[model samples]
Target: MCCAHKNENRGAFIVLEGTDRSGKTLQCQKIYDYLISIGRKCIKTEFPNRSTDVGKLLDGYLRKTIKLAPEVSHLLFTANRWELNDYIEKNLQNGVDVVCDRYSFSGIAYSSGAINLDYEWCKSKEQGLVSPDLVIFLDINLSLSSSRSGFGDEIYENIKDQNNVYEVYQSFSNYSFWNNIDASQDPDVSLKNC
Candidate 1:
């Protein structure tokens, strides 16, 4: 069972995003563990919570088991994020920081790759959603990302696709909350920067 938050102020909403092999998950886990050890109130969550019904549909689309139009796929991904909005808001309101593995940026970049969805348009589609207070981008180049172990076999797992997404992510660097970290570094170094 979980306990109530001890702090008075709302908790921070931190998001981890990046190209493949960017160490988002690894860092998130490490951060979660450290926070727990130190008794900081927090909750670790992720987009496409596949246990949920909407996420079940998204799982099929991601796995190529279900054929969806790019537009449909984009909406499903957005819906997947929405599925967690209430929980995220409630946690943050209670002062339990939320570490999210992915959110709107992934939706925008990945969806654009399937077709010609403009970055701004993709951003607009996510209007009214709860934005992350901070977004840590694991910056990894195409070559390095491809060479990483366990590079996925999924639809958006190729050099072209990855590169496309990288470019799109790059385009969003102007945002004040976006923080880019050199993902090629050792885990400790990356974690320190993150």
Candidate 2:
């Protein structure tokens, strides 16, 4: 519902948000591929990019190699998104849609889920970052989520944590720009909704 002002000619800034193993990556890739096929200039990226220094730090934390306070970890995730704000803006300005696998919403939901960190606090940390023109939430239950191929490889992998995260994601259902797709369905059917 928080729509930023942009020129009509600019490409859309799209975000794909969901809990762990919700098929966000696969669906995002499908959206990107379709956009390309239709001749839309576009680029796809994910949060905690894992290529930059902060991202590497995040990766380390995800892999359980380093330990930090929950609040600190959450801030790092928000910072990772801030790190890409300019790039997102640039792509949109140049008429290239920026499709993100995860954005500040995930940082807020996943980090605050079952934690002392407040949703408002986590949201405040990402205030200045670019907001998406469209947010597609891939809705799938935690059981099916854990059944995914790479379910437990990183942090926030368990059913309990994912359940809390899923609850937070549900809170965004009322947002005007948000759209929920049953990710448990066939990929082609899900893509059709996209």
Candidate of highest TM-score = 2
The parts of candidate 1 lying over 4 Å away from their true place are 1-8
Top-lDDT structure, candidate number: 2
Worst 10 residues of 1 by lDDT: 1-10
lDDT of 1: 0.80
Considering only N, C-alpha and C atoms within 3 Å, which residue pairs clash in candidate 1?
none
In model 2, pairs of residues that clash are none
For candidate 2, the C-alpha RMSD (Å) to the true structure equals 1.1
Please give the CA lDDT of all the candidate structures.
0.80, 0.87
Total backbone collisions for each predicted model = 0, 0
TM-score of each: 0.91, 0.96
lDDT per residue (tens digit) for residues 1-194 in model 1: 01233556988788889977678888888778878798889889877688899999888877778888877878888888888889888888888888888888899988885455766767777877777778889897778888878777566777888888888888778888888988888877886875
Task: Estimate the TM-score for candidate 1.
Answer: 0.91
